[model samples]
Target: MYNALQSYTSYPFAHLVFGEGGDRKTLNFDHRINILQIQGLKVPNQKKKPQDYSEIEALSKALLTPITAYTDQFSRMDNSLFKIIGWDEAWAPLSSDIGEATMDSGIREGRSRNTSFALASQNPTDIKGELMNNIGNKFIFNLDDPVQIDRALEILKLEKNEKNRENMTLLGNGECFFRDIYGRVGRLQFDPLFQELMNVFSTTPPSEEDTEAIHQAIQAHTEVMV
Candidate 1:
């Protein structure tokens, strides 16, 4: 079926018509949502609650913070990405090693350029789990199937591209919301980055000075017990 939005100036309201797709031989599968006025039920004279500005502002702030933070984090993925399956666009999923070679052949900055193989979605968790599992250790909640992984990637890829960026959106993939309450920004590679920094601190190379700086930053950020 199809959905149609029609507007009429004088009527002061829009009409929503839902129906089956246009066919050469059939038109019987259509229905209009606002046909109630035709049935004499428009404006039943019920008083509605007035608008609440304070509540709206608070909710708006809460919602905007996370969404903006997440998009910003996605923008940084190319810097240290290893295995991202279903998160955002701007990166394409290739089917074979030929494609991996194609990407790595260019010396682009994305760290995930030459991954072994793009995991599929079936029982597999979304790109978040993919990244953690592929790069980190075991997880109790992480799913482990290629079809589920692919299915999730497809849903997220579609949701991300089709929706409005400035407004809130509802997203789902069989189950799971890619964009959630907590901001997705973090030292995602904290352990790995920390290890690398440690290794550099130990290694006698040109990067030893930079490694000392990273060690100081870690110490500065670490919490001290009172």
Candidate 2:
């Protein structure tokens, strides 16, 4: 998911990532990308210095303020404006009063503004009913726990049948049971067309050697394109 959003950096779209820790390093190198580290609820100021704050309201302010600004900037274009706002480990932030509102606003008005929210979390049930109701598409990945599966299915409004439970538990990595915008449900697999992206998008910590190799591969690929 991080890699998919990172791809937009090469284009004209605006992408903002809200995540934490070592994961930030993978997406931070590019000047076009903006990352909001969620730890301590610290937000970057105008000078790029993080100001630490503990208020719950701060979360919504940090996230929605910029999005509102960006929407105003791009929504004026003759054509639709395309933008992506991603939040990793989403459950925590979504629980807050204004955090959910921010998400709700994005999902509700996304179509007209041409914005996409890439929110990710381990369990779908952790998300609130109101926020989930606003989302049109859903991707259910593997769940080993039967309790979580039941709850997730209930929230998704799918039948709590054996077949559905079995299918979700049996899913392999990179595979998910998807509900599209039109509410059609089916299985889906993600296969990246570009092989070099696997290295760049990997969740594992990249060694110095691996970093150099991927950089060279991307350089070579870009050269070929030119």
Choose the strongest candidate by TM-score: 2
The numbered model that scores best in lDDT is 2
The stretch of ten residues in a row with the least summed lDDT in candidate 1 is: 32-41
> In candidate 1, what are the lDDT values of residues 1-226, reduced to their tens digit?
1221222212322221222446533212122111111111122111222253344332333333333343234434444444332222212212122222333322232343432222332233423433432322221122334454344444333232323221112222122334222323111112344666666545356488877998887887784531
TM-score of each: 0.15, 0.60
lDDT tens per residue, model 2, 1-226: 9886454343222334334445445433223456655443433232332355444334434565654455344433333446677788776556544456667777787777687777899887767787787887888899979988997787656899999899888888689888877878888998988877976777888899978998999999999999
> Model 2 residue 70 lDDT?
52
Off by over 4 Å in 1: 1-93, 105-146, 149-226
Clashes of 2: 0
